[model samples]
Target: MMRTRPLKVALLGCGVVGSEVARIMTTHADDLAARIGAPVELAGVAVRRPDKVREGIDPSLVTTDATALVKRGDLDIVVEVIGGIEPARTLITTAFEHGASVVSANKALLAQDGAALHAAAEEHGKDLYYEAAVAGAIPLIRPLRESLAGDKVNRVLGIVNGTTNFILDKMDSTGAGYQEALDEATALGYAEADPTADVEGFDAAAKAAILAGIAFHTRVRLDDVHREGMTEVTAADFASAKEMGCTIKLLAICERAGDGASVTARVYPAMIPLSHPLASVRGAYNAVFVESDASGQLMFYGPGAGGAPTASAVLGDLVAVARNRINGTTGPGESAYAALPVSPMGEVVTRYHISLDVADKPGVLAQVATVFAEHGVSIDTVRQQGKDGEASLVVVTHRASDAALGGTVEALRKLDTVRGVASIMRVEGE
Candidate 1:
């Protein structure tokens, strides 16, 4: 039996994603209602600019006051497309307090204050679903949170940010410098004007924090993630990557460390082998490689951003939350029961590809080797090329703690024979 009473949904924000959500809800209203076992209605839409005309939304639904809209006691679901902390957080909590479930695409807010938000939802006995937060429409959070609930996920490594991936992929394919690739991405509208959040790894770091928390069932905050921007990635880095039969990508990596006692999450530009699934992920696309004991290795790939793609994910969560509401229940809340401690970056063990500018002399290599040996970072390979009394010495190291690699670089910088540390990139997927 289907419910005759319509489920009232309030949309906060009428921007790109919000508009698409409304469009879909209107066009696919019958289908959504049939699937959800209840008629879904767009009861209200709140935006900052009420004067701006939205295609399908009613003028009566548009309002400047977001708080007032969410506070409306009749709303059954509040969908937040507003991507920020202040108003979004407060609005979500208010929605729960007033008896409404929430579906959000705010990664930054969730990554920072997910625990509090989850608590608020639990207190109000409402569902808080954010499937679109991490990788646009890639369907990641649900799998890690629900699908893989029975399995133990050991590792999650992938290119999660499409902007950074576009820049890095451009650099690899065209041998363009970072500026050139970033400029192209901007012109193509794949990058924002500021682009700091995406290029600087802040965006990916937030996603990493979310993934690490859910995958490991721990409370991983945004501050817990180790972030390194890809702005410094040069054509020379791509050249070195090609020489090693690899390609460069800005990766978000999360892992369980040392018998699952701790977990780690980081975002950085790293060299993944050419054959790896992530290296082949070209242009503004996303792919994640998940490793587990029973599942072995699984890859989730898709267009990570854009209004329609992101809206698809938001609608998926909408149907889910709607169905749960019809059933008089809630979905999975925060699974931080594991409470695994997030280890510092220094404790992360990984291989590294380090390029150094040094004097073209015999003992320079020996001095560098001594530093690595002293720091307990074993070198896997060393390649030296000389030109005009200057040499570019590239050293690939075996799996070693980040602490040892940092000490090695610090000591190498102090050496007179070493001109400078040109670049240091982590080697992954091998």
Candidate 2:
């Protein structure tokens, strides 16, 4: 019953991920054909540098004009591995218009304009699957979109960025400072030269936006996600965390508010209990915890990046979309039925680990405790260390709104006894 006519697939961006995708398609042609009920052919490969030699790809099949390749109405699928906004966005839209479904690995573009892209696919009656967008090889999107379609997911918390994890893990294991750990990450090729996107939480923030939108069934844009980078994470922070039976990690957290009427998405460096699954997720690996009403808790962990891993996800989507094509159907589109409002960061309720530099004297602690009390932030515990008339007062506050914590810090900074607000981090996964 297999179709003799092969399905033509156009590959855009012959880079790290695109090349691997092509290699896989060619090597696994027979299997894909049998599984998909149709032989899959790599019709064209679009690349900026056509002269660059790509092994296993035909020289005649390469083209510099990506737009034109996708415009060919004969294409059944357009796999976009170009990790950017402009060209990828336009090409993806164009592909749908010309009768081709899309499989993309562009996180930034999807996180930015996923609704628009989904609409484009739906308008043309095509599938737009981006399983490779969020967490490289890990199958996160489809689960949130399809598998958990019946269940209500309340909380999603985990270490989503591998680069930051590597840096933080190195610091925790080797007692290295932020700079030292970042340098090691860069040397090991775990971090980029600039590393702004990964370290600054922008990368994780985009993924958070995607997760929140899907998990909450609302439109969560990139701007909606509150992002705080890991650059400010210091060795002393790790020591403080260790003392509290915790470790620091850059986490992407999405949650439904108390009433389940609103949602919150944020990416930042926080202290998670050492016993938590995410804390043990060392090296450049990704792990996510999905808490639901029925499923209780589910953890998805794997290598979140690299060519081969990402390509695997891309191929999974490709096979799915191919099956849909053969069946003359499409997968689930955007599910913003709830349309819950995304609450601001100030409204987010979580514990705070605040370190303050204060004068070593009586009544200083009382004044600080009064500030917390006045702001409605109850102190769970307080530890003070004095040295040469200067003191480090570490306070862990019970669950409180971010606005109250901000107000407390502002009030503490104004007190003459308080030298500085040394550091403030959120305590999560407790």
Candidate 3:
């Protein structure tokens, strides 16, 4: 009979998610051990400041040395929750070298250097599962990699960052500007003080890369994701969306393009129809809508991030990796089989809502119409306002390349009749 000993695990960070991982390890020890078919022990915990007070974990398990913990050679698995690009990446690689599997929630590291990490795991024949890295606690990664393994997903649109979603939700419901909604989110602990990652679309872009990689079986890096944040969106955009039966949500969209020969990923504030399921997703919650050729439409919705919620995802990966280890078999490795080129944003085809300020005159509409026509973009609908010198001309365009629309805007800006381009919003969920 094979000797069954406890699976010794080490945590590389003792922050919010790490703390919950430790807590759950102790609270649900028996159940986890039974499911894992062996003992699951918190062999060690690494922290930057070991003196920080942590509840539920015995002081003996804590250590200030993170590198030493991964070097413990005896460790069966290493769980890393530290979010960064440098030390976390190095440490995870070290763990794989030391013959231990790794589970991480570092989206930045994953999005930037995922191919390297996956190659490392394949070389060592060890499991590397990161379910919590994207759409925290939503069980998306494993399902995309394993359960939906056979399905050919065509599109994945997600509200993956909770802080931005909360702020945007407030803006959508109350017509609040970016700062006002951000202040409210910060007061409620939904946003941090600096808020660069969430408000600037950095966080969503990172998540988009990861989701795109798995959903489309392509290698998508952070640089390939086109990103536009919600800071520039105003009440006028929201009002216009409401008038058009739409709601604005920051979305990370991944689609196969080039006649289904390539993949593209982008993060931007978009107008989703009020009747769509993603439009109903409010507050700080997250949701991902996936469309496949045979699977049809599927939606995954849950808490995007929190200590306990993220911990749930971490534990799920731990169980899977541990099981694969015991079975002497590895999990699904990186699947970039399609190896499709990540297309740039300008090449993507989508509908647009362009609002422009023009002179309230008869020939103004005709001039604007000519500019769009010159760029090969057809207008779906046109709305004009104002009785005197000031007028607003809103043009909703049919599906066209972003490059074509951009050229039309540049031409209109230099025109003698058009005053300014008020705003341009992408329309989706139609």
Candidate 4:
């Protein structure tokens, strides 16, 4: 007879991800038991409203008082899907203090206060696993935290937000403007009513913070990430992308500085060459590309977010934490050992594509090229076309610091020959 520990789990929130947690718990019971060498059971469910009907769940398991549920006796694990910084953080801390391991899908809470939560878990010697907090259902946090435990990771570049990727992919394939693609995504339920977090790059920035901290074993907080949303990305940007043999994607990029003394993490819309693997990751899917000393380039791709997919990731973490419990061992904790400083955006090195609307004069092109030269940013290519009293100058520059590029743009904007600086975009995945 196999020795069974009879794990009791309390799940909070029955939203998209929580319902899937219940469904999988019911169907995978025997398999879960076999894998854990024990019977895992749902002890309780914490929800805001108790009157709402929920299926595949024992009515006795549901409760309106979430705080009271965590305080109840004998909970082996608490899975939090409520998602916020306040009660969720307080509830998770309480659960850990009460001798329960925690599995969470709360990215904001984790990104904002992961350090505090991890400290609480450490003080109580409990597990705090949040595999679903990043890319939904993609095996990223685990692989970065564990599988690459020995490898030296230099970079983690990803399309970590699904809604933005879906919108961008739609725009890429259909040549639709930002609003047009956003409308289609909204109609399809891929985007929320507000869509601020997804489109504005806030969501991806949080994920980047979490990923940078883990990959570099440093405390890279959410505020440390430089965020520039994709709302400003126009249809013309996509058209220019096509002209340059590229696609525009909202990328969450984190990389170790060349000196290896610091790291840089940012979320912004970027133009990437079509040959890159990440360019092929279309629709609402997510992909993460990692560069390491030992592992040169590695990519993990799958459905980024959905209730069921994210729940699947939580369950996978459940199995790992459960087995670790049976063995009386704790997994890795926050490893900011690299303790690298988070660098500013001005220090980042990348290529740029600058579109200039200038007065149609004989020397306008040379004046624009002169501005770039003064800043030490060499131009790779320049294409100019004259229109009615105005000319459009498209200049692609070789790699240079963001500071240098910004200086060049500032000087160009001041030029008498330049009517206006239309746009400046970063070129990535080259």
lDDT of each: 0.94, 0.95, 0.91, 0.92
Compared with the true structure, what per-residue lDDT tens digits does model 1 show for residues 1-430? 7899999999998899999999999999999999999999999998988899899889998888888888889999999998989889999999999999999999999999999999999999999999899899998999999899999999999889999999988898888889999999999999999999999999999999999999999999999999999999999999999999999999999999977899999999999999998889999999999999889999999999999999999999999999999899999999999998999999999999999999998899999999999999999999999999999999999999999899899999999999999999999998
Q: Worst lDDT window (10 residues) for model 3?
A: 1-10
Look at candidate 2 and tell me the lDDT of residue 94. Answer: 99
Candidate 4 has an lDDT of 0.92
Model 1 residue 136 CA deviation in Å: 0.9
- How far out, in Å, is residue 162 in model 4? 0.9
Candidate 1 ranges beyond 4 A from true positions: none
Clashing pairs in 3: none
**Tell me, what's the RMSD of every candidate?**
0.8, 0.8, 1.3, 1.1
Sorting all predicted structures by lDDT, with the top scorer first, yields 2, 1, 4, 3
lDDT of 4 at 61: 94
lDDT of 3: 0.91
| lDDT of candidate 2 over 1-430, digit per residue (tens) | 9999999999999888999999999999999999999999999999999999999999999999998899999999999999889999999999999999999999899899999999999899999999998889999999999999999999999788899999999999999999999999999988999999999999999999999999989999999999999899999999999999999999999999999989999999999998999999999999999999999999999999989999999999999999999999999999999999999999999999999999999999999999999999999999999999999999999999999999999999999999999899999998
